[model samples]
Structures are given as structure tokens and as C-alpha cells.
Target: MTDRRGVVAKRAEDLMPGVPYVRGWNRARQSASALADQLVLLGLDSDFPGLVADVNVVGDGLVQLGTVRPEAAELLATLIAAGLRAELHGTTAETPATARREAPAA
Candidate 1:
């Protein structure tokens, strides 16, 4: 479908997050909102729902993840593979949000 700008638009789900994965990401990068949706696909939702509560799209290739457990850090490699970079914020006993070391993705 073409937008008002006359640019052919692709479905959000059809766009992959990583560059090497598909050409969809290229078109996705042109729109901030669309790219953000693509990034969500790379999130640790299935196996680690509690691990991440929220995903905030910061930019074309950046996202801030709200994590409940330290294990959420294990997603770094997957995130990288998805052509995205992430910052993890975990809830701590001392505070609601704190930076913790990332653990390996098991």
C-alpha cells in the first residue's frame, strides 16, 4: 500500500528487525513508529514474559527494556542479531530501577 507521500508501505509484521535477515528492515528504518514495532518481535516475550514488562522505542535502532529479572540481559545477543541495541533496566530491592549486569541467554 502507498501512503499519502506515495511511498509503498509494507506490513509491520513483514519487516524483520535485522539487516541481514531481510530487506524489510531497510524500509522500516524510514519510519520511527514502524521500526519500533519490528523491534518488539525480537523481545523475550514467549519464554520470558516476566523478564520484560515494557519496551520503549528510543530510535531507529535503540530500545529501552523494562525487566523484572536479571536473566533478561541474556537477550543482548539476540537483540544484536535482530539489528537492534537495548538498554535493560531491572527492578532492584533498593530501588524500582537499577542497572544490573546482563546474564547469558540460556
Candidate 2:
């Protein structure tokens, strides 16, 4: 929750083919990959799985998480994994265990 500057600036008018999204870089939590394993969180075979909306590395140790659309708990998890941490912000928490039961991995 360092700063949502990126998230706040997102426009619903610029969504991708599959879902709307936002992108921003984190200065505090630098991801070896993307913020919050968003890719993995998105589940495999998803269109635009790891689409980052806005990204910026600033001077202060702060990672700005951008906006996300079709904002689902699953998608949020992925964003958080990239580097942005959200506390008490979970509403759609779905794990692989339940996923297997629902769609069973191929």
C-alpha cells in the first residue's frame, strides 16, 4: 500500500482484449519477475495473463500498484505477488486446491 498513484491514473477506456488492467513498478518491493505472481495467480491459459498497466520506479522506496479491472480476488492476488502488498483487501481468494476441483488442471 505504498502508493496507488499508478492505480488511480488508470482509465477504464484502455483495457486489453480480454480484461482491463493497470501497470506500475515497485521501488520498495522489487520483484524477481512481476509484482505478485500475477501471472501464476491469473491461472494458466488466460488471455493477457501478465498484462501490467502502468509502471514506474521512483526515488523513494515505494512500489506503486496500479489499477486492475474485472478486478477479481484472483487477479488481485497476482498483482500483490508482483510486489505490491494489500492487507484486508481480499474478497476473491481462490486457491489451486479449489481450482483443481472446479476446472482440474490439464
Best by lDDT: 2
Write the residue-wise lDDT of candidate 2 on 8-79 in tens digits.
333343344533232223333455245455445545324333444333222223233443444344544454
Model 2 regions more than 4 Å off:
1-29, 32-38, 41-58, 73-94, 97-106
User: In model 2, where is the ten-residue run with the lowest total lDDT?
Assistant: 55-64
- Backbone clashes for every candidate come to 0, 19
The TM-score values for the models, in the order shown, are 0.22, 0.27
Per-model CA lDDT versus the true structure: 0.35, 0.40
**Which whole-number lDDT from 0 to 100 does residue 92 have in model 1?**
21
Report lDDT (Cα) of residue 82, candidate 2.
Answer: 34
Best by TM-score: 2
Give stretches of model 1 more than 4 Å off. Answer: 1-36, 43-64, 81-106
| Cand. 2 TM to true fold | 0.27
